[model samples]
Target: MNRKLICYLLSSLLLLLNCNKVMSASWEITYPRTSSDSDKSTDYPLKVLALALEQTGVNFQLIPSEKHYTQGKNLSRLKDNREINVVWSMTDRQREKDLLPIRIPIYKGLIGWRLFLIREDMADRFKYIQKVDHLLKLSPIQGRDWPDTKILQANSFNVVTNINHSALGPMLSNAQGDFFPRSMLEIWDEIETLQTDNKLIIQDSLGLQYPAAMYFFVNNQNRPLAHLIRTGLEKAVANGKFDKLFNQTYQSYIDRTKLKKRKFYRLKNTFLPSETPLDRKELWFKPN
Candidate 1:
């Protein structure tokens, strides 16, 4: 190569390296791998997160966990690592304390409204559920680390806890738990993945409701990244990009839920973060 061309290439390389450093100076983010676990990994949380981060002009490289952390371990990893710049999960007082929460309800509050998954044969059994007390009698299954475990148990609902996400399906089908509750956005896609034997079905009659939201959480010490994420999300909301993305992503599930037709039982969420923007109607996803 000519000396002039070589000098120019070297300078260009140095400039590009400096730019990457500026972008990734704070944190490298991650979400657990789920492609093998799902037929089509929708990554709604990650999608919204990417949109918000774009507004901030910060550079982020999404590092998939080589540890193969399941949903339960993902929570633990967040508390232990500084490198996990972002993860999207349910927010509670404890999680907010352990990690710096962006406080934007990514799923809106719709994650709190749950639909039941049960054996196909048990659908008729839940049809007569007339009140919260009746629904409480049925055993519900949740991940050991999930906030829903504590949320349901506090409400006097019988809840079975397991650490593995894959095991919940078998446990429910084998009658270890009477039912499993999934959020409105998740039940339709998740049920398709779990119904391997065709015996597992989504119980259509009754739904569970709580006051909760999912937020992007970073390691407690990473305040700059948290601020960057919050700014990104706020910018998206300002430009109408956030709602447009949300509506396009979830419209079919919203149409299918028919919230008015289902009997819903509200449960109390003792650990919900008080800062949750309950006033922001535009941010939350509800099938009304």
Candidate 2:
């Protein structure tokens, strides 16, 4: 072959190899996972994440961390970019400072609309408690590292906390806490998955209302990934795919709550950051 032709062919081959490498490269996104068979809370958020990535037309792989960590540990790992690259969590002032938040409420604020899981025997006592003050006298079980624990404590609601997420149910059934305040989106699945034989019933008469946002957080330095995710999520929201998936996942549970019939006591979410998009009514769920 002529020298010029050989040089051209070699350059073409290198270009082809570089193109292949670019095509094969994908973002490796890691998220926390637990061994509990009943914990399906991550299902919807993970789906939303997948949807957002799809919208961005980005090549990415979603991975569950091999090591199970509590919510706090997962956030810490994400902040350090240690194992997990992304974490979905309730936003607080400090959390936003530690990580880049997408600022979209993945649960549409449903995470703050809480219902109580009380021992079946305590049903009558809860039924008569019409005032927030009366209910504040009862203790609620929460994860030690959960934002809800601090929110409850800030609101003067006695909170019993355990580091283990799975232990909260048993604590409620064992009377270690007077009641377990769970998100309406989570209570039904949790009740069905309760391994204990002790009867725990949803306290139907009253609910707690606060303004909270569950956001997808990435390492502070991962601005490109953060921007991509936010762009994809905004696209999903504008296209109505976000609300559709959200409804398909939690509509039945919302119906079961009959929130219209329940009187809700409003509490100030002191942890909620001032920058939360409270003006975006389209991004929140308001029970009629």
The prediction achieving the highest lDDT against the true structure is 2
lDDT of each: 0.82, 0.90
| Model 2: per-residue Cα lDDT over 189-253, one tens digit each | 88887866578988888889899999999999999889889999999999999999999999999
| Candidate 1 lDDT, 191-288, residue by residue in tens | 77675454888777689899998888888877877788899999999899888888899888977888788888888998887887888877876554
Please give the lDDT score for candidate 2: 0.90
Clash counts per candidate, in order, are: 0, 0
In model 1, the Cα lDDT at residue 19 comes to 84
Return the lDDT, model 2, position 151.
Answer: 93
Compared with the true structure, the alpha-carbon lDDT of candidate 1 equals 0.82
Residue-pair clashes, model 1: 0
